[model samples]
Target: AQSVAQPEDQVNVAEGNPLTVKCTYSVSGNPYLFWYVQYPNRGLQFLLKYITGDNLVKGSYGFEAEFNKSQTSFHLKKPSALVSDSALYFCAVRDVVGYSTLTFGKGTMLLVSP
Candidate 1:
């Protein structure tokens, strides 16, 4: 089965507003969760990761994520967002026993309007 899934195709928010990008995962043992943002024609920038310990993890660019063991979910959240925050976001999980590469979701586009 695929490791991670992002339910939303896109999330729209006005500039200076908060935003959330939903994500869920299925992995053996403790999952290595990571959130990345991709701008057009650019590589994905690592935002945050939840390797172990602490359900609530903070990250770059005023972003954070909550890891829910019961629900097998990790959702990304940002407060007081900016238009610069608008980008294609991807949630990924490292393999339990495979290569070091991570499995990514389809991606959720966050559009911060003016």
Candidate 2:
């Protein structure tokens, strides 16, 4: 079975500082990784994805992720943090060879203080 782990329950960062939300995943064969952000009472919005090609992938909202195949990690990164960026972030993975359904991590709440 495929799975994802977001070790941090929450991440705290001051506005204007860089921010990161760690994520690790496990899957058989090639993996399709994704990051999604969910605002309060809202649906998950796609942030970025790592399916193939470039190890470093960029996405919406000044966010990017580096795919480390050896470490099985896809950690999200932002050069600067904003209070408006605070939200519940989730890491998901899918097995590219078999199924298309995504397995999501519990989620990490990002708190950006001004």
> Which candidate should be chosen as best, given lDDT against the real structure?
2
lDDT of 2 at 96: 91
RMSD (Cα, Å) of candidate 2? Answer: 0.7
Candidate 1 wrongly placed segments (more than 4 Å): 97-100
Off by over 4 Å in 2: none
lDDT of 1: 0.90
Predicted candidate 1 versus true structure: per-residue lDDT over 38-92, tens digit per residue: 9999998999999888999999989999999899999999888898998999999
- What TM-score number comes out for model 1? 0.92
Native-referenced Cα lDDT, model 2: 0.96
lDDT of 1 at 25: 91
> Tens-digit lDDT track for model 2 on 1-113?
89999999999999999998999999888999999999999999999999899999999989999999999999999999999999999999999986569999999999999
Worst 10 residues of 2 by lDDT: 94-103
